[model samples]
Target: MRFIINILCCILAFSSCTEIKKYHSIHAGPKPIAVVIERNPGIRVTGSETPLSVLYENGTLIYSEQSEADIPFYMKKELEPEDFKILKNEICMTEKFKKLRNSYNLCPNILGSTTVEIYMSDGKNSKAVSVYGYGIELEKIHDRIPYPDKNDKLPDEFRRIFRKLTGLNFIEAEKWTPDYIEIMIWPYGNAPEKSANWPSGWPSLSHPLTRKRGDSYSLYMPGLEKNDLNDFLDNLKPKQAVLINGDKWSVDCRFVFPGEPLWMKAFNKMQ
Candidate 1:
C-alpha cells in the first residue's frame, strides 16, 4: 500500500509540472514589464529608436546607447532570478511609486528635443511618466511653444526611481540580437549628399511584404542568420539617406527587441 501511494504522488507531481510548463510556453514569454524610452523628434522627424532600457518579466534586460560618433549599440543581459525578484518587489511594493500620478509632460527644448518616458507595471499597478525637461539651449522662441519655458523638477522620490532603473551598474550585457528590424521607407527625393549605397539582398520598395504606413511604407527584415543583425545594419544610419536601386530614399531602422509586440505602434500611449 505504501508503494502504491508513492506512485500516485509522483504521478500527481508530474502532471502539475507539465501543466505549468505548458502555460509558460504559451502565455508567459518575456513580456515588457518596464522600459525607459527617449524619443528625439530631431532624429527622423517622426522619431523612433530602441528604448534606453527594457526590463522583462523573465529577468531579461536590454540596453541601447549611442556612441560619441553617433553610432548606436545594443546589449542584453539576463538578471539573476533573485536580483529580478528584489527589483520587482521594490517597484511594485512601494506605495509612493505605485500611487504616483501618470504623466509629467512638458515641451522639449527649442530647435528640437522630445519626451523621455518611463513605464513599469507588475501586471496590475502600472506607472507611466512622461517628462520633457527644460533644454539649456533655449531661445526666445521657447516661450512661444505649447509647454512652459521653464520645466519643474521631478520630486526626489521619483527622481531616484528613474535613476535606479536606468543605472544598470551591476548588469553586464552581451551584444543584442533583435528579433526583427523595422525599416520605414520614403520615396527617393532631396537625398542627403552622403548616402549609403543600396544594400544587396534587401527587398524592393514594392516587395509583397511592404505595407503602407501613413505616407510611407514599411518592411521587416527578420534576424534569421546568426550574424544577420550586425551584417545587415553595419553601414545604415538614419543620419544618411540611402540610394536604393538608383533612387534616393529615406530609411529609419527601429529595433524590435524580443518579447515586445510588433514595433509597439502604440508606444506613444505609454507616455
Candidate 2:
C-alpha cells in the first residue's frame, strides 16, 4: 500500500512534466530500456490492447497478455543477469537504430493496419521509431527511400533487436498489477437481455470520465485496486455488455502508468 502511495506522489509531483521525467517517475523501479507497441488505437478485447511489452534496465519485464479471456491482465518476469546482459549488449552494438530518425511514416489515419512503435532509452537519451503497416506484407510504393525516414518493412537491425527482446526466456511469470487500470465505457445499443449489472463500487458510468490518448475514451479507475477490479468483473466476459444508469454500455479496459496521461494526450494530438 505504501508503495502505491509513493507511485501516486511521484505522479502528482511530476504531473504535466516532460515525457522523460514522467516516464521514469518510479524512482526505485528500473527504467525501461526498450518498449514495443503494436498500436491500433482502436477498441480492443479486454486483454489484447496495444503497448505489447516493456523491458527494464534491471531485467524486469512487464507486459499485457491473455489467452481467450476477458478482463485483461499484466505479467511480470525478472530476467537473469546474463540474459539481460546479452540483450543489452546487442542493443548497444546495433548502430543503425541510433542513426535512423526518430519516427517513420506513422500512418495514423489508415485504419485496420497495425503500426509498430519502438522506444529505446539508455537513461540519458531515448529514441522512438514508428513503422507503418508493420507485420503486413507491404511492397515499397517507391524504390527510393523517402525523406523523414519511411521504410516498407521492419529494418533488419531493428527486427533483430525486436525479436530478441520480445522472445522472453522465461515462461513462468506471476501476474503483475500496475498502479491503475484504465477503463473506457460507452452505452451499448444492442445489449443482450442478460448482462452483468455494473459493479456497485466501481466508478459511475453516467458521470463523464475523461477520454484518453488514443482514438477512444479511457479513464484510470482511480484508487481501484487489482483485487477489487478482478472481483468486480470476475463474472464478465470479453465483449460482455454492461448495464449502468439504466442504459447499456460496453466496457474496454487497459493498464496505465501513473503519468501515462501526459504521453497519451500527446498521442491523441499527434498524426
Candidate 3:
C-alpha cells in the first residue's frame, strides 16, 4: 500500500507540471498600451547634441549608462528574427528569470510617450518649456562619421523588422547638415558585433556619441512622415485643452520648426 501511495504522488506531480506549462503558454504575449501625444511645440533649434534623461511614469529610470545593463528593455528594434530565439536559449541555459519569459513580452505601450523639456538660457531669458514628445517606435541608430553622407540612414532589413514587430513605420530621414553629429545604433542583444555596419555604445553611454534615444533621433533627421510627426505631438499632452475658457497658453516659438509641419497635419487629422 505504501508503494502504491508513492506512485499516486508522482502522477499528481507530473500532472501539475503539465497544467502549469499549459497555463503559461496561454498567457504568453505582449501587452499593448494606448499612447497619445497631447501637445508639442517648436523651439529655438540648436545643433548641439546632448543625451537627455527619460523618466517613466513610476519614475523608475529604465536605462543605464552601460551597454548591456537592460538589454531586453532597450533593443526592441535591434533584435533580428533568429536573435530572439537565441535570447530564449540563453535564458533557458542561465535559468535567470526564466519564468519571466512567460510573464512579459516587449510591447509598444511599455514605453509611453516621452515629453522633452528643454531648459534653454540664451544668457538673457531663462525658460523651461516643452520641445517635443517622442513617440514610441523602433529607431535605427546611425554613425556620426557619415552624417549627411550615409547612403541609408536605416537599412531596409532593419526597417522591415521594426515594422513587423511594432506595427509602426520606421521612417528614415534624409541627410542634412546638422552640428555635432552623433550616431548610435543597436544590434540583436544576443547577437552583438555582427557587422561593422552598426554603431558602438547603443542605448546608453558616457557622451552624446554613445547615446541613442529611441526614435527621438528621427526628429533631427530631414525627411518627415505624417504619422511620425503626429505621434510625436500627441505625446506632449499639451495644456491647450480649451480655447474659449480664456486659457491662453503662450507658445514657445513664433514659427513652427521644420518638422512641425508634418506633425501639425497629424494633429489636425485627429481633430
* Number of the top-ranking candidate, with TM-score as the measure: 1
> Once superposed on the true structure, which residue ranges of model 2 sit more than 4 Å away at CA?
1-30, 41-48, 64-74, 92-94, 105-111, 136-151, 187-196, 205-248, 257-270
Choose 1 or 3, whichever is better by TM-score: 1
TM-score of 2: 0.61
What local distance difference test score does each model get? Answer: 0.62, 0.60, 0.27
Candidate 3 displacement at residue 266 in angstroms: 37
TM-score of each: 0.67, 0.61, 0.17
lDDT of 2 by residue, 125-223 (tens): 766766766632232332243433432444677666666655654579887767656676666658655777877766663333443344334445643
Worst 10 residues of 2 by lDDT: 136-145
Model 2 RMSD vs true structure: 9.0
| Per-residue lDDT over 116-154 for candidate 3, one digit per residue giving the tens place of the 0 to 100 score | 222211223222222121222223322322333322233
In terms of lDDT, model 1 sits at 0.62
Q: Candidate 3 — worst ten consecutive residues by lDDT sum?
A: 249-258
lDDT of 1 by residue, 1-271 (tens): 9999999999999977875553233223577777767667667636455677888878887776567997767778888899889877775426776665555545434445555666676765556666665222322254465655365545455566666666774446687866556677787576556777766777666654555667676666664542553554565665666776676777766766655542243355653
